[model samples]
Target: MEVVNQFVVSPCVSVCEVDERDICVGCLRTLDEIARWGVMSHEERMHVMTELLPLREAGDVT
Candidate 1:
């Protein structure tokens, strides 16, 4: 696998809201994930991006 050196393209769609489970409605990131994004390494952000699917499927976000 290749490691990307730039900040992962943010999944945010300008609609920022967290559901009761703490998942963002816009990007499907949890509150902790969102809070940590700015300081996270590029690879870290990418990993977080990849983790969104399960959150979405689990009904955490639309």
Candidate 2:
């Protein structure tokens, strides 16, 4: 068996303020996402960092 280590870092930019929509203005994560980040799996964190955050930044997602 191979042991693989995976680490997904948080996207917090130290702004730490939610907008009117309850999305973080710095990291572009929803309040729920932020709250669940620590408990989320590696894949989930990657999804947020790679897919979701980009869409949010591009205004493709609300």
Candidate 3:
């Protein structure tokens, strides 16, 4: 049997802190999402990335 390996990039911009909106401005991810990323499904991570892309385009970096 072969195992399917999925991978993702770390969203670290140096500063690590969760904002009032529960999203990490640096990584554009929610604190809970970040904590559970390693075990999250590929589809779930993709969803997070989709949510992040717009914020990045909007210059919402931290």
State the lDDT of candidate 2 residue by residue for 1-62, as single tens digits: 99878788899989999999999999999999999999999999999999999999999997
Question: How many clashes (backbone N, Cα, C below 3 Å) per candidate?
Answer: 0, 0, 0
Give the better candidate number (2 or 3) by TM-score: 2
The better-scoring model by lDDT among 2 and 3 is: 2
| TM-score (all chains, Cα) for each model | 0.69, 0.90, 0.65
How does candidate 2 fare on TM-score? 0.90
- The order of the candidates by lDDT, greatest first, is 2, 1, 3
Whose lDDT is higher: candidate 1's or candidate 2's? 2
Task: Give the residue spans of candidate 1 off by over 4 A.
Answer: 1-5, 54-62
lDDT of each: 0.76, 0.93, 0.73
Model 1 C-alpha lDDT per residue in residues 1-62, reported as the tens digit of each score: 99756857778788999888887777788788888889998778877777655658686644
Scored by lDDT, the top model is: 2
Can you write out model 3's per-residue Cα lDDT over 1-62, one digit (the tens) per residue?
A: 99867676766676788777777767777788789989998888877777664665486742
